[model samples]
Target chain A: MTIEYASIEQFYELIEPGLNSVELAVYAASITTFFALILVLYKRLHHDKLNTLPVNISGFGYAIPGTVLAMAMLATFGPLDNLINEWALSLNIEEPGLILSGTVFAIIFAFVVRFSAIANGTISGGVEQVAHSLDLAPLSLGMGSIKGIFKVHLPLLKSSIFVAWLLVFVEAMKELPAVLILRPFNYDTLSTQIYQLISDEQLEQGALGAISIVVFGLLPIIWLNKNEEKS
Target chain B: MTHLIDIQQLAVKLQNKTILSDVSLSLEAGDILGLVGPSGCGKTTLLNTIAGFIEQSAGKIVIDEKMQIDLTNLVAPEERNVGMIFQDYALFPHLTIRENIGFGLFNLDKATCNSRVTELMSLLKLTELAERYPHQLSGGQQQRVAIARALAPQPKIILLDEPFSNIDARLRNELMIEIRQLLKSLNMTAIFVTHNKDEVFTFADKVAVMSEGRILQFGSPVLVSQQPNSWQVADFLQLGSWIPVKCNGDSAETAIGSLTDVHTENCQTGKTESSIMSLLVKPQHIRIENNENVNVEINHVGITEQGYHYIVSSLNRTDLSFDRLSFYSHDVFQLGQQLAFEIIHHEYLMFDQAPPR
Candidate 1:
């Protein structure tokens, strides 16, 4: 088949809308929050009596199909919003209609639940690679455990933390099923737009967005290769 | 000698298994105590327990006549004021040598910390490598950095776990001597655990031999070597080979000959039943005899600076065959050749033989 390239002006017009979409903004914001939440949860649960269980529980989303995860989130939040609204009404306050299920919150929630394992696994592996003696070395030198972790472990885990964030960001960008089921009205991400175009038998029009996803996916691979070579 | 650290009946249990028990040890100020034992005899565990890394199940650890710890309360490792040098050095790889030495001094002002780091770097001969990271340095240099870091805080007591085990054999003794001098010059009280008994002779003021989570003997290196309290202590030290003997009151009969001057310090005099005993036979105590038909076969021979040392086993038809007794000879002897020998005049040390299963 002969492929026709879009003119520069037409290309700019086609790609600019996708880049400026509210779905992209939500993706960025949700992923930032998700990364922060992973750090907070990992830090809190790491040394607890539960050990890795809390992190593993959060990682359960990775084992389930994204479609199943989307349905589970919908099932959970759809009624939680109603219960909140019902309580608001009983208290004689204005009803906050579908506050969670009818907005970007549900989509972000699904993304976080599905991709937490990647962040947890990366950080946990990084933490494990550090010698247990290194953990106690600072303690012997008169530094508290919390301070020692910050001084010693966090600096050591810098690359791993960045890698985890990048991986989750890229994964969230390409997620389709969860976004498709959980997105509010009029919201469209790169993957959803590509999906919509393909469904309409106009895959050629969505080629640039699909290629962007591929380009993003190659980043960690190149980074890992560079690190291995450096080492 | 003022005691800097006193451990009273310290016992540790991990996950329902006893790791250390009745480990009572006392160290004077500026003294170096070597914890020598076979593998898995709780040497490292005792060090960790004293360092506050492991919680004790019973007894107390009293330090510098100040801090005290028992089962109910555990002073956090950070708050214990006890320093430790691990086998792997455990230097913060991300930090420079100067920074590592200054890590314990982080709470101090910048100038004071810098001065302390400089002082330690000079003391440990690491001033030239101060800018280098741990991985950039050699093993011995990294261990020096670990020592400098551990000492930066001026801990009341320092614990080292197999500190020199990773060094080259030729360099290990030199490093031990140098570190011993450094510790002595600084008047630092420290305890180091190692499986090498010779390290104790070269590096420690007092040596402890441990087995099955209990300290078998604790005394000066010379004292422990001169008089090992138990069979296990002498065996662990490998001070001498055992010569089986039949004990009859004050006298003992051996394969080499009867020992009329047997020392009964380790045995009871009025035993109703005769017992089989083993005499500690040092290599210097055995002398070559001119007689040819004595049935002593040279099992192995190796050249030493003193002479050719031969390990001869008794081929005598007597029931008391003393096997693998090391004897030093000025002349080389062929392996498996029969020779005559006699015990020189020496203080006899004998112990009851282990009961056969």
Candidate 2:
């Protein structure tokens, strides 16, 4: 088969899915990293051995393959969605069909579960580098714990949080298995669109999308290398 | 006047191990209490307990005569109105100096907060560095910012954990004096922890010597230095050398000399049956004799600001012999030189050979 360059119109056609992928990745990474930061702070400051169990559990998700995680999400949320629908039917109300299993929420949930370990590891290491006294100093100054975290810790953790977000975003952009399995019907991310083009033997058409994904993936590596050199 | 801070029977147990036990202390307003001890002796633990950073497993803490903290009625650190300066100063690296000092002033009006920040900046001589982050400043400057932040909220009491440990030795004393004057001017009651006894003498109005999770003695710096009540206190303070003494009837024999009327008044061994006691012999209590048997050989010599300091070991190879006998003199002494010395006739102070079990 001849490998002809795709027309500019075909490249422009991929922008919508590319933007959608960026948007989804941003939301999932932000939410996951925020919770990861809170979990880290709680584990460090509370000194509770039990708190570490949840952190360990969150990190265990990374060990699971993305395809397996997507399947697990479907297996878990499908039943819960059916139970909700059954309850609505019994009450003579309109059933929200496939609310979770057939929506973007499933894909986002799969991404969060898959990438939470990265966020947790990066953020927790950052928090550990901070002196424990930083936690107590604000408290001693009559600042409540929540406010102190936002004012004192979050500022100190800016670089770590940014790195975590970037890592998760890159991973989500490159992730095809989970997105292909869990993405809602009629919704297409860059990864899914590229997978479709490659499946249909239109490599030239998907080359632009493929390059965008690779470029996004290189962001965190470049940023991390720069930081390592600085330090 | 009511005590600004009162800790009664405070005990802290971490991970099933007792860190501090039955610790009690009281400080009136404007009082500076120094907690001095060896490493792992729980001085910093006591300071953290008082600051509400560590929960007391037993007893209660009263701050400003109103807030009482106990196991049943727990108060968070922020609500305790206690401020702290950590060993590393714990200054926020993200915030500028002005923002750091103004951190706790968030509850106040904007004008009041700005005014307080400005006031603390001027007071701490941080006005010029107000825009700089913690990493941009020197160690002393960071410490001043930490102090300013702690003082911004006008806390009921201040707790400092090894505040001067990170400071340059040359600047430590000067910083301590300046901070002491600032605390006194504000009439802010404070407790500071340090392993260095000299810091206590230079910085604290009262000194509490601690060992094994207990304050062995507490009093004015001079009193504690001159008349430590326990063997641990004297040994930890390096107040003097311990000379082994054996008591017989109304007299005691030492490696140095014998003393008549070795009554129980000056004896604090707490063990009546044990005849072996250790005498707390100060360096000034010893005098060189012109004609006598050489009883001590100089083992170590160093120059102090006052004069030459020598640590000599006993030449008499007997049960009563001891090492690390320290004294100072203007006359030079060789490292291996043997000398004759006698304990001057004075009030005798004796303690147990070891801490009371």
Candidate 2 lDDT by residue in tens digits, A25-114 = 998899889889888888877876697877778888899998999999999999999999999999999999999999989988988888
Residue by residue across A33-133, what tens digits does model 1's lDDT show? 45644564355424545655666677777898889988998899999999999999999999999889988788777777778788777777777778879
Residues B1-357, candidate 2, lDDT per residue (tens digit)? Answer: 788888899889999999999888888999999999889989888888878788889998998899989999989888888889898898887788899899889899999999989999999999999888888999999999999999999988888888898999999999999999999999999899988988999899999999889889989999988788888988888888888887765678888777777665544343543377888889999999997688889999999987999999888878889887889999999999999989887667787665432
Query: Over 4 Å off in model 2, which ranges?
Result: A1-4, A219-231, B264-274, B354-357
Give lDDT tens digits, candidate 1, residues B202-242: 99999999998999999999999998888888888988788
What TM-score does each of the candidates earn?
Answer: 0.93, 0.94
Q: Please give fnat for model 2.
A: 1.00
Residue A78 of model 1, lDDT score: 91
lDDT score, candidate 2, position B200? 91
As for candidate 2, its clashing pairs are none
User: What's the distance in Å from true for residue A228, model 2?
Assistant: 6.1
